[model samples]
Target: MLVILVALLWFTTVEASHCSIMARLSLMRNISELSQNNYGRPDLSHTTIVGSVLHGIKEIEVWLQNFAPGSSTPIHRHSCEEVFVIVKGQGTLYLTPSSHSKYPGNPQEFHIFPNSTFYVPVNDAHQVYSLP
Candidate 1:
């Protein structure tokens, strides 16, 4: 899975570079540039991510997200499929949302541990709840 993800990431970077000059010329990042977080959901701690955007890439955006214990995402969906790779810690992935709702109903859930990869289907509601 990790190998496949890497290949996909590389393939996407190359594919997206066709859209812009910066993306074509600057395609890498260093550890020093990352920030600690993303934004907010509801009752959870602040969502954090360390991401260097090859900003303006077509069809792909990648970020390294971290979740402190007890942090979680509100159930949500995206027009495009979203992937999550658990680089560290443990969590529960909620899946198969019951309706066309953005965040609704009892859905199936799975426990996730480090190095795991999963994706929310296009338009399917899903969330990841960090474990203590």
Candidate 2:
């Protein structure tokens, strides 16, 4: 299991009996039914994002991305750390030392297979390149 500490967000509410402050979410989520969003890069036409907001995941966010062969995303960074899981297919994971435009110089590559899990640190630039 890939557990990520994307970020710590604190939510406060006024004391009220109408709401169960300790209520937690315990339900099954279907990937097929989840909404998918496109990546920022237009060339990443082969990539789609499956994202959602869950009840118990207050301080964290979770989602899945689908990549087709030859699909690649531009080097990018996020304020929060990212977690990746190769649930299916094969791909190449790319990492660079810098987040600048000329970054990814001397980039590191990794072979990604199904059931594999990887992570990118906060503000660390990285990209994914899909393979056949």
Q: Please give, for residues 9-106, the per-residue lDDT of candidate 1 as tens digits.
A: 21242443344656454456563464533454333322222122344445445555555677776777666666776767787888975456665568
The lDDT of model 2 is: 0.55
- For model 1, the local distance difference test gives 0.56
Tell me the TM-score of each prediction against the true structure.
Answer: 0.64, 0.59
In model 2, the worst 10-residue window by lDDT is: 1-10
| Clash total of candidate 2 | 0
Q: Model 2, 20-65: lDDT tens per residue?
A: 4225422565646655455564333221221123343344445555
Q: Rate the local accuracy (lDDT) of all candidates.
A: 0.56, 0.55
Candidate 2 residue runs with Cα over 4 Å from true position: 1-28, 39-57, 98-105
